[model samples]
Target: MARIGVLLMAYGTPRSLEDVEAYYTHIRGGRPPSPERVAELQERYRRIGGRSPLFEITLRQAQALEARLARLALGHSFRIRVGMKHSPPFIDEAVAGLLEEGIERLVAIALAPHYSRMSVGAYHAAVREALARRSAALPVAEIRGWGSHPLFVIAVAERLKEALEDLPRQETMVIFTAHSLPARLREEGDPYETELLDSARRVARVLGLDHWRFAYQSASATGEPWLGPDLLEVLEAIARQGEARHVVVCPIGFLADHLEILYDLDVEAREAAEGWGLSFRRTRSLNDDPLLIETLMALVSEALAD
Candidate 1:
């Protein structure tokens, strides 16, 4: 029997001041996001208790996924582990855990659905780098991107339905948002923006919603151009359309509650909505949702079968 190793990966957050500078530098590709910039980013973490729950949340995500896999009964013996791109309980630690459990083959999956060169792609690189460090070439399988997954589409639709249930539905604009990437990425043929749009379109279609738009959020205004029209701009546009008392932002791209969802949408966007006299509501993240785990189980079953 071939042992199957299951891995969940995420873009990690620093746990302490010791990690602040190094983490910032790695993300900036050795150029550094600037000490001031890094300090600003750190304060966001500070505001939320001086540490991020990303690593913790991802660990629970792995736990839930593994439990679901067991219930779903994937015949191959396997162990599930969580790995972070830039922190301890790192990729190599997870890989080592799998090896300890005698998992001979691996299936690497990102908690994120879309494949951006900066996001999911980075996790893939981490796996390869870890393998190189170990002098081992494990037979690996990967799920490139699952934004178009039928279950994911349905999940978004359900989330949107729940939020729109009480809101005065007349002329309420729907804006689906994801984290933004640099403009150069699209010019270089990156599909980040395209993938997000496709997912949003499918989710909207599933809901039979015609009044919908897509926007990018949490973009940096640093010298380089980033993906847009930004969420605030879109919100303002909808407000300007008149009689727009309500706007719903479905975070169709993200699967959990992180900084972008917390500060970006809940804080910054909410402030903008109030300024424009528009009611604001965002779909709750599908954190450890049972159905979400079912979808992951199905995804795992699909990959292992092939």
Candidate 2:
């Protein structure tokens, strides 16, 4: 019997400081990064323990998801593989491999919770390109968005509660942040920002968080403006208000503890908060959490049933 392939995709990270240049170039659409930009990225990676564990974490997620699928599906055969957008085991490669394995049916799910044409759509395009190149006619089902999945919302809200366990909830302002995209996408009516905010709202509603809000983070340095109010600006504004001294940043958009979380939030954001005399803490990333695994399984089951 032919097996079903579940391709788990994520925004790839550099394996080590040495891969920084290549990773940066890949993100820039093959335009190599300047030496200064390369050095800056290398320093960020160095600060976060000299490398990102994203690939390994994603692999673990795939293994766990495969096991769960096995138990859930019984005699059904399901094989899971990890795909990266900008690193090794690229989406196109993963698609090709699944086709080679005789997987007639595939479910391609982006690790990202929200959908954006620029992000999740790109992964689908990669799969299509690979199939076109191989002259294969495999049927692929894609999970476009699960931002408001109940289990996912609950899991993130639980993490937020854990982060606020000791901090005074009344005094703490909860900021839910997602990676920023080019502002032009807004004009294009990309539903990413809307979907992202909807997810955050669901989690906040679950936790009964009245002081919760949303912001954008990790905007690119492309001169053209990205989404806002940026996370750092939100922190500074809270300081100015002298209304809340404790702030909990929930990275609603990211599923793992990659550079954006490790360096951007832990290091840069922390410093900014300290400078503003505010206590800063970020909710733990849901990396390989059982809840996350369950969420993926739910999505797969739903896709297969449909």
Candidate 3:
């Protein structure tokens, strides 16, 4: 009998303000942050209720996915777990737990819809390291990118439609956004940007949207050039044009509400939009959206079939 393990992975968040430094260190790849830098990071978490619900939301996702799978009655033993990249229940820990559950096969996917070497690639590396450290050579598979999954596009389009219902469609410009990555990925020929654009385009087509554009958001302060024109930059430009009365930002890259959605989009970006005298509203995050769960289940089934 073959038991399967389905692991859901996310970027992770600190449990509380006090854990921000440790989380920051993990994100920096173990480079300890300066005191000032730590304070700045801590403040961001503080603004978002002094904590992030990323892990909790991901746990709910895992639980929901498990129940859905059980309903399918696949007649195979299966278990689901949530893992984080920069917090407790790290990827290695999740993998170890799956092994302990006697799962002979693994199916994994990141909460991120798109892929970047800096993102999904890092996740793959973490899984490999975890497996190697445990001396476990198990069959594992993953869906590196599901940005163009039909259900995913439909889910996004539905959300966009719901957000635009009260606004004059022609007077609004839909801005599809995703977390920014380093500009170097372009020179390195990473497929991340292209995939992101593809997802945005598909969702727009589904909605039959005419006035829409894609922009990057939440760039890191890594002292390197990042993908842009940023959401704020785009909003400022749109305000200058005086064409659209409202700007709706749909974060196609993120699937859940976290610091990025709460602070980056709602707080920071909203402030920028206000400065430009432009109306700003972000689409509700796809946290536990039934369609999103179905999308994940499809990915798991695809991995298991292979």
What TM-score would every model get versus the actual structure? 0.92, 0.98, 0.98
Badly placed stretches (over 4 Å) of model 3 are none
Which digits, one per residue and each the tens of the lDDT, describe model 1 over residues 194-295?
888899989888878887788999997778999888999988887887847889999888888877888788878998998999989999888777767777
- lDDT of all predictions, in order shown? 0.82, 0.91, 0.90
Give the root-mean-square deviation of each candidate in angstroms: 2.0, 1.0, 1.0
Error of 2 at 276 (Å): 0.3
- Those runs of model 2 whose alpha carbons end farther than 4 Å from true positions after fitting are none
Q: Report the lDDT tens digits of candidate 3 across residue range 1-306.
A: 579999899999999888988888888889989999989978888888898888888998998899888887776778898889999899999999999999998988888989898999888888889989999998889779899999999999999999999999989999999999999999999999999999999998898899998899989888999999898889988999886989999999999999989999999999998888888998998899889989888888877777
Arrange candidates, best lDDT first. 2, 3, 1
lDDT of 2 by residue, 150-190 (tens): 99999899999999889887899999999999989899999
lDDT of 3 at 78: 84
Candidate no. 2 TM-score: 0.98
